[model samples]
Target: MADGSSGDSAPYLRVAARLRSRIADGIWTPGGRLPSRGELGAEFGVGENVVRRAQELLISTGLLEGRAGSGTYVRAPFERRPLLRTPSAAGLPYSGLAPFGFTGTWEADSTAKAEAPPLIAARLGVKAGDPCVRTSYEFLSARQPVMLTTSWEPMAVTGGSVVVLPEGGPLAGHGVVARMAHLGITVARVVESPRPVHVDRDQAHLLGIATGSQATLIERTHYDTGGRPVETADILIPADRWDITYDIALPGT
Candidate 1:
């Protein structure tokens, strides 16, 4: 927020607006740490308390997070796992949520890699060589590979934590949401879109299915409070072992 830039509102509110714009415009991003109050005050020529107030306002609005001893940072958006257990929801939400009725792990192995594909590149808003988490998960279905998923996270936000991928690991216990939360990054929503696609020879080989067999492609993107894209995943599921179910009430039924 600029000093004496405008009038008629509380100083903190104006600061909040400016911070919001920076985040919306991608100046700040999920898992990105914000400047210290002293730094902000120096930049805007405002008092330290004024900057602190502004930060408090944004935190209350869910755009920023205040971490003890770590300074403030932009919070990760929420990733809505409707299928995962919520205290009040009845029945499991989706087939993918549980693999053979057992809780499993989502591991991050492999080194962080840069994205070169045009579509992924565009979604991540990064250049070809930008660093990202090269993560893969093998979901167990009665102790077999029910689904294979790969995810990519911006390295700037992950802070080198995305490289740990052993089974029964820290991430395995809490899933990605809890891991992000420990890092002060929250997932505000998760949007999943799944569609049927013909399995190619390569996919069939990994999934133990025949070429041209039917499969479902699941794509999910998670966003943060400030609406920055944090993580994205693509999963391939074999049709034979999985069932897609949803409930709807008919007027005359």
Candidate 2:
């Protein structure tokens, strides 16, 4: 232990850092059972949620694994793979927006349909009958679909001068967001909401899984600089092997 813990750091993070240090120092050897969440909370005089957040970080980082109701233990030291361009990689050029790092083949339809559904309509903030272009993409990582996203953009935004680009195609190699910016429409904020859902018949087929499987449903809404909606996307990810990292920070000064 060093000097007294700093108040500037969240109690949970401080606790997590201390435990991480212990593990790195070999104090808590690999394949060892670590303290229970409740025990760790009590040790740090913090709530279980705080301890849990810390544990989640370690788990996401491949340092720990939770064994259901049993307890969390140190993960075996697997071969450390080199850092690759994961979807969560910071400042990634296109943010993994394109599937498999390949120029994606576009789809003008939504799951074999020509029009957007009511649920998608609500997400795009458009009228039920409004024309929309749905772009379906599958991104593979390690030879598997690590990310699948379907986006609906208002046809109005695609018409007129922008009409040159067609459906079932990537946006002219300029990137969709960049193209929108060129049209004097700047995306100001991106709001992402993620929830776990049972994979339906269609999802199972596209994702190569059985029905009723668990998947993470991630919905993202892109807003313009004026706070107007520009596009909405729904991404389905198999829960067992996929992970999404969300970083929150204060806006740049």
Candidate 3:
């Protein structure tokens, strides 16, 4: 047994690398349970804490999954589906937001009169501390949580209107474009900026992934024909689960 202290790299990282190699080499098949921390510590000549950290690193990388009351195991490979994004159109149904072929249900809650944070307010073209309707959603497929989203709409845009509450009134469950159109605001385009991010504790718990797991954060906003922002949202998708694809129409096509 070799002590993990021989190299300059962190002890846990070295152990994690070796374990990753072992898994890649087929020493541990997919869904195969790994030996206990004590056993791995003994074999690696390291402390149990080091082994635990190594396992955690692998878990965050989606290479392993830990089951409560059960040992950690190699994660089984999964198909990565593509989430399609296209230009915004008037009257697009809320169901159209689902990934292709994703026959699942989503739950959403809207909080009216919520104050918009600085970042969100900027995205919505509103001043900080402005009242906004905040809606959070959890999209599930096959009963497994797949996506999380939090959207904000400036109250100034929808205040006192029937569509003020995104998930309420007759426009309930209608998408942003349609909801805005109901208010006589013509939605012209949708813009999205996608960036890689690490899932936070709350997000990880909701997505059923380890904290610090890789994910994508998409900042999406709907703009009216006059170029005024109507709504802005943060869309979170697990990196290991889906790929985002944009559908851009060519000019004059």
Best by TM-score: 3
Task: List residue ranges in candidate 2 displaced over 4 A.
Answer: 1-114, 163-174, 251-253
lDDT (10s digit) by residue, model 1, range 126-159: 6666777666666643233446777766777775
lDDT of 2 by residue, 158-249 (tens): 65554324332345545456667767787776777889998775665454344576777878777788877777888777676544555444
> Where is model 3 more than 4 Å wrong at Cα?
1-58, 61-76, 88-96
Per-residue accuracy of model 3 over 128-203 as CA lDDT, tens digit each: 9999999999887755578899989999999999999877899788778788889889888778889999988788
Report the backbone clash tally of model 2: 1
Poorest 10 consecutive residues by lDDT, candidate 1: 80-89
**Cα lDDT of all candidates, in order?**
0.61, 0.63, 0.82
Better-scoring candidate (TM-score), 2 or 3: 3
**Judged by lDDT against the true structure, how good is candidate 2?**
0.63
- Best-matching candidate per lDDT: 3
TM-score of 1: 0.53
Q: Cα-based RMSD of the predictions, in order?
A: 22.1, 14.1, 5.2
How big is the RMSD of model 1?
A: 22.1
Instruction: Write the candidate numbers in order of decreasing lDDT.
Output: 3, 2, 1
TM-score of 3: 0.72
